[model samples]
Target: MKTMTELMESNIKKNYVFSFLMNFRLSNGLWMIYMASRGMSLTQIGFLEGIFHVTSLMMEVPTGSVADLFGRKLSRSIGRCLSLVSILVLIGATSFFHFTIFMVLAALSYNLESGSGEALVYDSLKYLKAENNFISVLGRQEAIFQVSSVVALLIGGFLGTYSYHYAFWASSGIIAFSVVYSLSFTEPPILESVGRNSKTFRGFLKQIVDSFSLIARDRKVAFLIFFVQTILAFSACIFFYIQNYWKGLGRTEFQIGIYLAAGSFLAGLVAMKVQRLSHLLKEKKVLIILPLISVASMWGVALCSNKLPFFMVVAMIEAMLFVAGNDYINKLIPSRSRATIISFASMMYSLVMIIFFPIFGRIADTISFGVAFVSLAVMASCLYVLSMYLLKKIG
Candidate 1:
């Protein structure tokens, strides 16, 4: 048997490799900008966003189940391959139709990776009886993931200034490394041995149903899932448009890159401190209050004449949604359906994104960013009230 130190060292290596690869997309900070630059309308961009989520909503649960049954290492390898192709397609895409098609493929790539890595690391720790480290380790992994994104955002901006093609090409090259890493990455022997417990299709379907039943019966789980899905989905759609919003504010491409990099740095720092914050506030209050803070910051963006508050709030949103909230949920869930249940939350977010992204896009096109954001704030406020009822029950 491997020593705990040995397993942890391997796990951290996999974590950084995958984390870096995941955020290394060259189109990330500039995608909506690139699409718009090609003469696509705001609504068109929104429609593509909706399509991406539709793809993800369809695939999230099944791919997650596959990870649970087969092993994260194999599932992640498949995801990395799809992600690589998706970026290549985007790099070569010349028309709106091509972009849409490539985005659908990219959605598939995200699903394959979504719950797989977290499941791998968490289960590996469980097997090693080192569950205590899961939160801090996961938090650290989550935090630095954004650090890589700062690199991607800067790279995308720098290359995109000359030509978007350069950025796209560079992103694909970075992901090539991740693809190799994924294939070579080892699953914990315990997880590899789980294939023996793999279920038939019928059994898998039953497990999904039972998982939904668990959600239905457990108000805390259901609420947490609902709360995270709603706010994250809303904020994600909002964040995507912020690139254009910056353009509207008279910022140049390079200036936008600097803003993104600065915000990302703050987000990384906040994510690293998530465990400490959780300890200070406690998880229940964290869930309760952070969402409120997130909503307020989002609304503050709409209300502010200056964009600095929006940038600060954007950092908070990233830290809260991606890093803090996710680790908190991980702590609550049992191992057996961990990936499946997390995917369910993710799937729900995809569904919400599908429904609302286009609507918000149209609003931004027809009206203004401020008006669209105000609408989001109203929706978020109502949801926050409802979430409080559920958050109280979690503990």
Candidate 2:
């Protein structure tokens, strides 16, 4: 049998490219929000983000089923190309409408990514007879991705200081690099059986319906999906608020970059150890406990008077919980319909956020950012309790 290290080495080139692209993509996650704040009102920024979320929600199921029926490599390549185009459009965008167009494209790209790339990697490993090491390998890959985000965010902050457009251009270039890397990849044979029947659009629809029916019938799966959606919605709220909070701390762009980089770097480190963590805790328990910890940490940050403590607490919580939660969700999802399930869950979460984010942003503007944080924390706390009840009921 091929050892895990040997199998990983066999595909190191493709894996590195995928990890780099992920890092490049996430690097701008925070900076983009900060940029939107500069040229628009907070409500407008929230609305634009909501539009992105809406588009992603619409595209998720279709793109996910495409990956399942076609091939992961093809889906990933198309997604990367779409991402490149979106970045180029973002670079040229000057108005809210223009930003909306770019957001739509970006959302579509994210939908394509929902299941394709990671699924390809998983299938590739299985072909190599290294499926047993999926969690560890995935964790390692995520760690690289986080490191890339830290670098990208740092550079993006510096670039944003000069011009926000520069950051978009840089992202475009990075995505192009990803495209080249993706083209060089060879799809594994393990996925050959998956796409045996050439699925028509109607067939795809049937698959989607069947997937939903499965979720509904499997109470464990349905509750897990709901639990994950709640966690993601709260996470989005925290991400949306944190930029404004950092500004309130009298921090510069460089300072903001440093804080983000520190947190992401730590998170990346933790992600590498996720497999070990899995050995110690059940995936469901880890999911619940980590988010609860995140809520408490957010409350601490919101209540803190000092910047140092606020930054430290926020970074620690984010780094520890985000990876743990994601890994847990990954475990719960079935590989056969991974993308579709993930997209379905993401769509539900985004739908919730689309309704609430604008309201929350307006409240933050009229009242206080602290109130926004506190309210979200309270909601997350309630959701955690509900998640526990669901887990028990389902079991």
Candidate 3:
């Protein structure tokens, strides 16, 4: 048997590689600019994003189930390959229709990774009887990759200064490497694999159905799922508009890069401590308190004109949302359908994004980014009340 040290060492190595590979997204930092450069307007961009999230929502469960049935390693490899191809297409894409196709494929790639990656890491930890470390490990890996993406974000911007193709080509090469690495990852033996047969298909459907039933029936899990979706949607709207929000306030074009880079660093720095925070505060408190941070952050964004308050609040709230939500939800599901359950969570956020993106985009265009920012804060505040009430009653 592998000793605990050996198991941990191996797992950490694999996890590190997995973490960096998962963040191999170069186009992320500049997608808005790239599409804008292609002559797409704000409405068109929002519509394309809506389409991407809708596609991701549709695919999340099936792909998560695919990972559970086949292997997360394979699922992850497929995601990276798809992302690589999507970036390649994006590089060659010159028209609105081409960009729409790119969004479809990119969204598919995101769904493939969303749940499978988390499930893979959690299961790997569980197999080694190191479940207690899952939160810590997850937090650390997110921290690492968030920092890596920070670097990629900067590089992507620099490349975009020359040509958007430079950014896309660089992104594609990174994703190709990630695909190779994911293909090499060994699946944990604890996962039950499905084979080609009607019987296996029936069993797969049953498992998915059971997972859905459990989430629906369990009030707390259901609340957590939806709460995460809403909070993330709030973040998504605020985040996507922050660059312009700052520019509207008379900040330099140079400061925008700093804000983006700072946000990533602060996100990583805060996320690294999520495990410790979760252990210290417990889930109930986390559920109750995280939203207060979101509320405060949103208010800060709406009210504060200075850079530090805005950026710091944005960073902290985002870090808290991701880490706390995952810490709670990961412990609530069975490993047999863990990926699918998480995908359901991902789907919630996608659904929220699909519904809200255009509305917020229009609001930002018609009224002001500040008004839209405050509006999302109010929505988040309402969600917070619901979260506290539900958790208080059942938790």
Q: Best-fitting candidate, measured by TM-score?
A: 1
Candidate numbers sorted by TM-score from highest down: 1, 3, 2
Tens-digit per-residue lDDT, 262-300, candidate 1: 777778778777778888998777887778788788778
Q: What is the C-alpha RMSD of each candidate to the true structure, in Å?
A: 2.2, 3.2, 2.5
Off by over 4 Å in 3: 1-9, 191-199, 246-255
TM-score of each: 0.94, 0.89, 0.92
Q: lDDT for each of the candidates?
A: 0.79, 0.70, 0.77
Clashing residue pairs, candidate 3?
none
- Once fitted onto the true fold, the runs of candidate 2 whose alpha carbons sit more than 4 angstroms away are 1-13, 25-38, 190-198, 307-335
What is the number of residue pairs that collide in model 3?
Answer: 0
Give the per-residue Cα lDDT of candidate 1 at 88. Answer: 85
Q: Which of 1 and 3 is ahead in TM-score?
A: 1
Clashing pairs in 2: none
- Using lDDT as the measure, what is the rank order of every candidate, best first? 1, 3, 2
Clashes of each: 0, 0, 0
- Candidate 1: residue 270 lDDT (0-100): 80
Residue 152, candidate 2: how far off, in angstroms? 0.9
